[model samples]
Target: MNLDELDAALRREFTGAEAERRVVVRQAGDLADTEKAETDRGVPLTVDEIVDNLSDAPDEGVASRWNWWMGALEAAYGGYEPFQVRRIPKE
Candidate 1:
């Protein structure tokens, strides 16, 4: 889907902190962590899933990239995956 469609989907699917977190993170490369976002379009996981992966990931850099949990989300997610929500819009 295009950026607008993705935004609508995100808006419909999430709100508040959850939605905000998705907006902050910038994904790139591949979502090797989870299948939530795996599809013809790209990763489809929610903000919660992303945060979980980040927390579980062996690397800490992923969580250190941004002012995580600033507002939209309230937890950590691994460094942005290429197929992540934030990255898809730019594509």
Candidate 2:
């Protein structure tokens, strides 16, 4: 799914597996090359540092948004632009 779709799912879906995995933003290029540095201060967006951090824990009114990145044994981010994602067996 596209990042936007993943984002919507992250916000609305509850798989009851918060402890399994988490997600972080990743650069398809060097982190220093983009404006994503701003998310370091805690914001959320894509391709721009202005809003690049994951959403702060989703509140009770926001569904599972917070659970998307709060607890996990592992976290992953896209390694390419228009960041496409598919799941495959982990080696």
Q: What is the TM-score of each candidate against the true structure?
A: 0.28, 0.19
For model 1, the superposed segments whose C-alpha errors exceed 4 Å read 1-24, 28-36, 40-43, 63-91
Which candidate leads the pack in lDDT? 1
Candidate 2, residues 1-91, lDDT tens digits: the string is 1444443444344332322212322222233344243244343333232122234444432223322332220243332222211222243
Q: On residues 14-87, what C-alpha lDDT tens digit does candidate 1 reach at each position? A: 33343343443433112324343344226455654445444443432432322232212222344333343433
> lDDT per model, in order?
0.37, 0.31
Error of 1 at 19 (Å): 19
Give me the displacement of residue 68 in model 2, in angstroms: 11
Q: Give the range of the ten consecutive residues with the poorest summed lDDT in model 2.
A: 19-28
